[model samples]
Target: MDHGRPKPDLIIFDCDGVLVDSELLSCRCLSEVLAEFGLQLSVEQALELFLGRSTKAIEQYYRDLLGQALPDDFLARLRARVLETFAEALQPIPGAGAVLSKLQTPRCVASSSDLDRVSLSLDVTGLAPHFGDRLYTAQMVRHGKPAPDLFLHAAGRMQADPARTLVIEDSVSGVQAARAAGMMVWGFVGGAHYRARDGRAILSAAGADRVFAHMSDFWEA
Candidate 1:
């Protein structure tokens, strides 16, 4: 179909699963925290419930699971653990660097994760130089993914036309947010979150223009 010709002026990438292989890190972090409460959660369960959500949502999940609020230091401890884990292993997705280097248009990263986590992930993956000051964290926006606020805020900051922007995402909520912001949506299916039938179907039904199984397949579309 020669889908490469109609290139957009800006490309927004999700940070976790799209740029770095942090889905497992996320699952492990959550599992470890929940396990301290005597609750066991599988990676698959964590991926299904927690991927693409904010830290607050995750904290609340823990609170709900334990029937009590997490300690005030819970977030800080979790952040430290996740940062330490990611620092040791923040491998970039294959072909991501090549694709970023080849992109002629302006590019930025808009992630549902907080600024600190986003910065750490990008830095560890060596993608920090490519993004520069173009990193937009969802915490700055009124709402997170599935709300379109974050994507719209990012487009505004970049001064890029939403209609001419392309968003690469791995979560159904992220895809829905991009579509709501009037941008072309490309679903990246190489993440743990989309491993299930329902997750895959949800993304497709959310109106992703295309789904990519790998970064190499992204150029094909």
Candidate 2:
């Protein structure tokens, strides 16, 4: 614990990269789908552009780049493919369950993914019972990560003072959102998606108060 700051009353967790190790899988699926549409993005490029963003971001990106809406079935196809892959490969972040089981602070998931997607992720990874109905998604708010809206909404719902809240996230946008919400934020770089990246530096630059590479170091960091 960082003795300087008050202990958090509530811990807000980001679902995709932070809770479930689904970032790489998601980006890869996205790349494949986009390629079918003649959009040639590698998994790395997809992660660079859409990590921590919602499906709305995908729609906007398609429109911005092609000057037209994505094919009407784009989201449906993407969702089906991603979910199919997730069912076969998704796993909770290492130590996530152990940490959650022992954590004393009140916590909930706040994700940029859609409600159905986030819910399914938790369910598939055996993290659903830990959160129950406490999952909050971008679809619930007008803005998602990097906007402060989602975090603020979660804090309000959890009745936690933002200044005393701690957010565990893995994306730059998520770190920025937590800071913008006036909360303490820790960047987690344990997911497979971060294998070759300097996540500590990237997240620190995005205003995370602390950055750690594994959930085993969560409290110690």
Candidate 3:
């Protein structure tokens, strides 16, 4: 039964859309925050521009658009709102818990979110025990997704050979990053946000080796 490519030595998962169903809430918050700055962004637009990107990248984009740095309290306020919202509304992706529980490969989470947000997402969804200190965030690297730095850093730290690592991602930037890291990559589109968005198309365009639409459908690597 074991045929074709070599089995993976490690698995890497992205957080928001891949592990937890937080993208809809996060994009809503992004829409709200950007509206205050007179940009009038819709949740779909926010998802297009900010999904799988770090807070620093988002802030810099806003600054570039507005021609000035954001207010000191902007990030703090956003974080507070997002954390409160997560405590109340965040949920794990459908079947993600069962999939993680059954997975035999050593796995870790690597996300564009900062450590605090990543930790809280895992905590709220009961996925924390699955990963614990195995979490890696873009803040831990010099560059985020689409640049290969974060994926390379995670693979290096996990002691996984890039050639034998399997990456599961839900965004274009994340897929690009994992592929650039010299690893096998699959695109996941299980998040509710994909209902109205064409995430799979973008993921395919970004060069994922395979694409799956549900956690239960994840391929064995």
Candidate 4:
């Protein structure tokens, strides 16, 4: 007997903190970059503003923070540093690989990060081969997370019905995007960036179908 097919036709995963433990590394890299300009920012501040956003959005945020225009090449330098740091220490979140390996449904990665960064993270975490050609980036959509364009774009590209997709996200912005795209959302709370009360509130306000405190919890659910 064919188990009557799984519930969701597709499973879309967020790359950064959900699949790879790169959130804190990203925060640290940006903080170090800002320090070069004589600006100091806490990890929490970086997470609040930069997590789940595109590089362009992150550049705009620094532009506002510095009260002046950033050099056009600033983003390039930042990207290089982030990539180097991630390559040196990148690892998958606890149980991430096992969970992915156990899934029976078609899976795809949809990330707010640029294609290069997304590819690098997945490569380091050893999840690149698992996804094959099913990677979707914010550049493929009209807008990033908090807009649903990325998730919708991924679903459309996969030819999967949006109603039958399940989005696994670790940020409120990502969860909101998936919800707006008409897919079920599962909020991942096992990452370092989402340890605060505000993070929990954001997940709730965004209407996550379920909040998982651990990878095992998600797998069990």
Q: For all candidates, what are the clash counts?
A: 0, 0, 0, 0
Score each candidate by Cα lDDT: 0.82, 0.91, 0.87, 0.83
Instruction: Name the better of 1 and 2 by lDDT.
Output: 2
The estimated TM-scores of all candidates read 0.89, 0.97, 0.94, 0.91
Candidate 3 whole-model C-alpha lDDT, 0 to 1: 0.87
Off by over 4 Å in 2: none
Q: How does residue 35 of candidate 2 score in lDDT?
A: 83
Q: Give the per-residue lDDT digits (tens) of candidate 4, residues 63-113.
A: 776676766776787889999999999888898888888888899999988
Model 1 lDDT at residue 116:
91
Q: If the candidates were sorted by their lDDT against the true structure, best first, what order would they fall in?
A: 2, 3, 4, 1
lDDT preference between candidates 2 and 4, better one = 2
The collision pairs in model 2 are: none
lDDT string for model 1 (1-221, tens) is: 13553678889999998998898888889789768766688878887777777787776676777677776777787788899999987788777888888777899999988899999998988888889989998789877888898898999999998988999988878898898999988878776455554545667787888877677776674
Error of 3 at 66 (Å): 4.3
RMSD to the hidden true structure, all candidates: 2.5, 1.1, 1.7, 3.1
Task: For residues 1-221, write the lDDT of model 3, one tens digit per residue.
Answer: 02255888999999999999999999898778766766577888888888899988888887887687877777887788789899999999988999889989999999999799999999999999999899999889998988899988988999999989989999888999998999888899989889987777888899988888888777443
- Lowest-sum lDDT 10-residue window in model 1: 191-200
Residue pairs clashing in model 3 are none
